[model samples]
Target: MRISALLIDDDPILRSGMKGLLSMVAPEVEIVAEAEDVQSGIAAIEKWKPQLIFLDIQLNDGTGFDVLEHFTQSTTRLESQVVFITAHEQYAVKAFRFSALDYLLKPVDPDDLRSVIEKVKKSQDDATGISHVELLLENIKRQTNSFKRIALTNSDGIHLFEIADIIRCESEDNYTTFYIRNNKPVLVSRTLKEFEELLRDHGFVRIHQSHLINLTFLKSYVKKNGGYVIMADQTHLPISQRNKERLQELITKTL
Candidate 1:
């Protein structure tokens, strides 16, 4: 299947290199237009209405974020899938992860690019909801440490949840089940390890190999028989010895 695409970047060399790489790896992705800045990028998008966009985070006139904002705030809906190409911007990267948006780090790797292309193909069949993009924009507007929303994608669809609403997470192999307040549990395909990294700073602790709990939802830590924690929903989850001390330290800090 041929995918119409636009490349928006300030560096002509990088744009040329990406075009070359795409020709070799993703021959189906046809580059319809290229732009060097926010205005031209927006103009190209309006003209081509490409199926995919490879956007640079930093442009000559304005950032790629400016381009997205221009469309997101307008009456027109951006139906195209965006892949942000960026250097090491830690805060922006975290926001993208929280929003469940796709991004590529510079300089791009062939394997990673191929993986992204595969994801794009899969997304075509099961398109992600526009809520993901809205959540991404919301996250970008907040202080990194104060990001309040997260997007979780499963077979059913993408779910937007307030970070504080999550009670705990349970792992079964590569999947994680999120227990939320006043909502049904959400099963996500992503690994517990991935969530552990993403949510650790937001008052979440991996108490065991199979259990991650939100500190705000922790009811009590029971020491009878074996150590375990009681959650807001009264579900008991075992605590592993390896993480016991860390949990205790965090609990003390919270108190």
Candidate 2:
């Protein structure tokens, strides 16, 4: 396929190197345009309408997330395959993996870049690929320590859930079953710790290694059976001895 691409990054050296690498590795992909900042990136995206975008996370003018927010909110609604290129090594990367979004770490390895290009091509052809982008955009819009939605992948496809609607999560081996409001419980192929890291700041507590509960849905703590939490749905979940004191503190604060 003749893939048209836009490179949006603050570092001229990195962009130039990437251009050369892309030319060598994926000659079919044509560099349509390049931008050094979020504003120009948005302008280029609107004007060029490229098939792929190599987006940098940080820019002098604004973060790459700013550019994505613009496109997401725009009425015209342009969808392009995005491969985030960043130096940031943190929670954002975990979110990317959870959402099935593609990202390249800096300093970019030629082999990894080539692999990402191939993945982008494959993702471009998949019907569900764009949904991952939408999920990532939703996550990017959230403030630190606060999130409104979570995207989970099931056999059918990606499922989006409002954080407020989720009551609790239970671990079963590698899978975590999310108990949600007005919907059947959805099982996702991920560990509980992964979710704990993403949701800890957003009022989710790990009452036990196998469970994570949203504080909003917590009704009361029962002293019986060691210690247990009563969710809004009246389901009883055990609280770990190690986490008991911490959960109590949170419940007190919530009350």
Say which candidate scores most in lDDT: 1
Please list all clashing residue pairs in model 1, or write none if there are none.
Answer: none
Task: Score residue 172 of candidate 2 by CA lDDT.
Answer: 92
95, model 2: CA deviation in Å? 7.9
Ten contiguous residues minimizing lDDT sum, candidate 2 = 122-131
Give the top-scoring candidate (TM-score). Answer: 1
Off by over 4 Å in 1: 125-130
Candidate 1 weakest lDDT stretch, 10 residues: 124-133
1-255 in candidate 1: lDDT tens per residue?
999899999999999999998998899999999999999999998889889999998999989888888886777668788899999899999989998888999999988898999899888754333687778878989988899999998778888999999999999999999999999999987899989998998999999999999999999998886799999999988999999999999999998
Cand. 2 TM to true fold:
0.69
lDDT of 2 by residue, 137-236 (tens): 6666555545566778766667888878889999999999999999999998779998888778778999998999999998888998798989998998
- Residue clash pairs of candidate 2: none
Q: lDDT of each prediction vs. the true structure?
A: 0.90, 0.82
